[model samples]
Target: MDDKAILHQYLRTRRDSLLAKLEGLSEYDVRRPLTPTGTNLLGLVKHVASVEFGYFGEVFGRPREFALPWFADDAEPDADMWAAPGETREQIMELHRLSAAHSDATIDELSLDAPGVVPWWPEERRRVTLHQILVHMCVETAHHLGHADILRELLDGRAGQGSGDPNLSQRTPEGWAVHRARIEAAAVEAEAAASAADTGS
Candidate 1:
């Protein structure tokens, strides 16, 4: 496949990987803040969708067919980073799906060198090509996918690209506990060695 097609595939794969992180999770788990920064599975999906719409739609002078309530002028800061009480999980998921389809169409229609502008970006760097946006979006999606992987693993100990993915070693809960303890022991040993060297004792 060509460069654009390859990048699009990577972007699409990460998008699916991210959504996979939410499968079998409850509303509370998917939306609950797992970090001090309020990072959550659903919130990450919403943020990525908003970003896709902006980069693929607005940046190219294409108008959106749907409204993003979280991005409205009256909305509070970081609104796109979360789902409001009334915003059902289905709605956010649908938005994420729709955003991907919309972005795919844009990528398919434009040439790699097709020029566009990002008004919100620095003036000197506002002008961009489809190739640049494709790379940018791929990196953006992959970055958030990393966060989703951690959040999902923390939520249920389910890890890897998806549920029961063979990419991860098969280990029982007891086995995993032993594995973790081994790593912990190594860390403690390293820290003690560092302290001793610092004190020259």
Candidate 2:
């Protein structure tokens, strides 16, 4: 595949990886804030979907076909980061799928150098091309996928790009326990060493 196709594929991969973090999780598990900053799986998906459409759709002058109520002038701040009580998981997932389709269309139709402007960006740096946006979105999506990885692991001991992905060490339950204990011991040792050095003892 060419450069654009390659970039698109990478972005698609990150999107899939992010979505996979929700598998086998209950609604509460997916929506519950995993971090003090309120980062959650469903919220991450919603935030990415919103930005994907804005970057690929509005930036290229291809107006969105649907509404994003969170973006309205009177909506609560950071509303896109969390689903309201009335918003179902299906709705958020559908938005993600639809936004991905829209982004894919933009990627497919435009050359890498096709110019666009980001109105929401600082005026001096708003000008961009399809290539820049593709790279930006890829990085952004992967960043959230990293968060999803940790959140999913916190929810359950699962981790990796997808189900049964062999990217992680194949440790049995008892082995994992031993591994964690070893790491914890190392951390304590390191802390003690650091304190001793700080005290010049």
Candidate 3:
């Protein structure tokens, strides 16, 4: 595939990876905030969906067909990043699917070099192209993908880069414990060395 196709393929892969983190999880599990910042699996999906809607839809002058009121002008900050008390799994997931479709349409209709402006970006950097936006979204989604990995693992013992393959060592529990201990010891040594150097200086 060409560069644009390649980018879309990668973006889709990351998006799916992020979504897969929610598979087999209960509504409460996916929505529960494992982190102190209240980031959750479903919330990360919601956040990325809105990211695509804005970056691909509004940036390209192709206005969104539907309104997302959570992040509206007067809405609470980062409101789109988390589901409200009454929000359901189906609601968030459906929105994600629709937003992805809209973003996909923008990617399909525009050339990689097609230029547009971001109203929310700094004035000096407002002008951007489909290529840049695609790349930016890819990175942004990847960020959430990583978050989902840890959050999912925290929810259960399942840990891997994706649903298909975890890419982690197949070591037994004892082996993993030893490996973790070794790493901790090394970290402690490194910290001590740094502290000694600071005292000497």
Candidate 4:
């Protein structure tokens, strides 16, 4: 594959992983915020869809057939970062997948050097090429995938980098607890030493 094709493939791989994180999870569980910042599996997917739609569709002046309610003028800020009360898991998942398809079309139809404007980006970097937007979107998708990975694992103990073979250590719960205590103890020791050095004690 060419350079653009390779980038698209990598982005799709991460997209699939993002969706996979929600698999076997209930609507409540998938949408439940697991972090202090309200990070959740479903919310991360929603955010990715919005990113794809904006980066690929709006940037290229290619209108999508569907409207994104999350981007409406009156929509609450960070609305894309969550699924609403009435929002179903299927709906969010479908939107993310559809957005991916839309982005893929943009990637396939345009040349890597095709010029476009990023309205939301800084003035100095508003004008961008297809290659640039593709990379940006890929980076956005991958970053969110990391968040999704952590949320999924915390929600269901399903820890892995992605689909296929797992990346989790094959350790029992007892072993993991001991490992965690050791790390905590080491951190405490290091902090105490640093404090003493600062005090010249």
**Highest lDDT among the candidates is held by which one?**
2
Can you tell me which runs of candidate 3 are displaced by over 4 Å? 162-166, 196-201
Query: Candidate 2 or 4, higher lDDT?
Result: 2
**Descending-TM-score candidate ranking:** 2, 1, 4, 3
In TM-score terms, candidate 1 sits at 0.95
lDDT of 2 by residue, 1-201 (tens): 999999999999999888878888999999999788898999999999999999999999987988899999999998999889999999999999999999999999999999999999999999999999999999999999999899998888887854467788878779989999999999999999999999996
**Per-residue C-alpha lDDT of model 1 across residues 22-82, encoded as one tens digit per residue:** 8999999999999998999999999999899999999997868878877888988989988
Q: Count clashing pairs, candidate 4.
A: 0
The models' CA-based lDDT, in order, is 0.91, 0.92, 0.88, 0.87
- Residue pairs clashing, model 4: none
Model 3 TM-score (2 dp): 0.91
Considering every candidate listed, which one attains the maximal TM-score? 2
Q: Residue 131, candidate 4: how far off, in angstroms?
A: 0.7
lDDT (Cα, tens digit) per residue for candidate 4, span 1-201: 999989999999989988888888887898888888888888898889878888899899997877788788999888999999988888888898789889888999999999999998899989999999888888888898888877876886667753335566677778888998999999999999999999996
Over the full model, what C-alpha lDDT does candidate 3 score relative to the true structure? 0.88
The predicted structure with the larger lDDT, 1 or 3, is 1
User: What lDDT score goes with residue 37 in model 4?
Assistant: 83
Instruction: Specify the poorest-scoring 10-residue window by lDDT in model 3.
Output: 157-166
lDDT of 4: 0.87
> Once all C-alphas are superposed, what RMSD does model 1 give against the true structure?
1.4
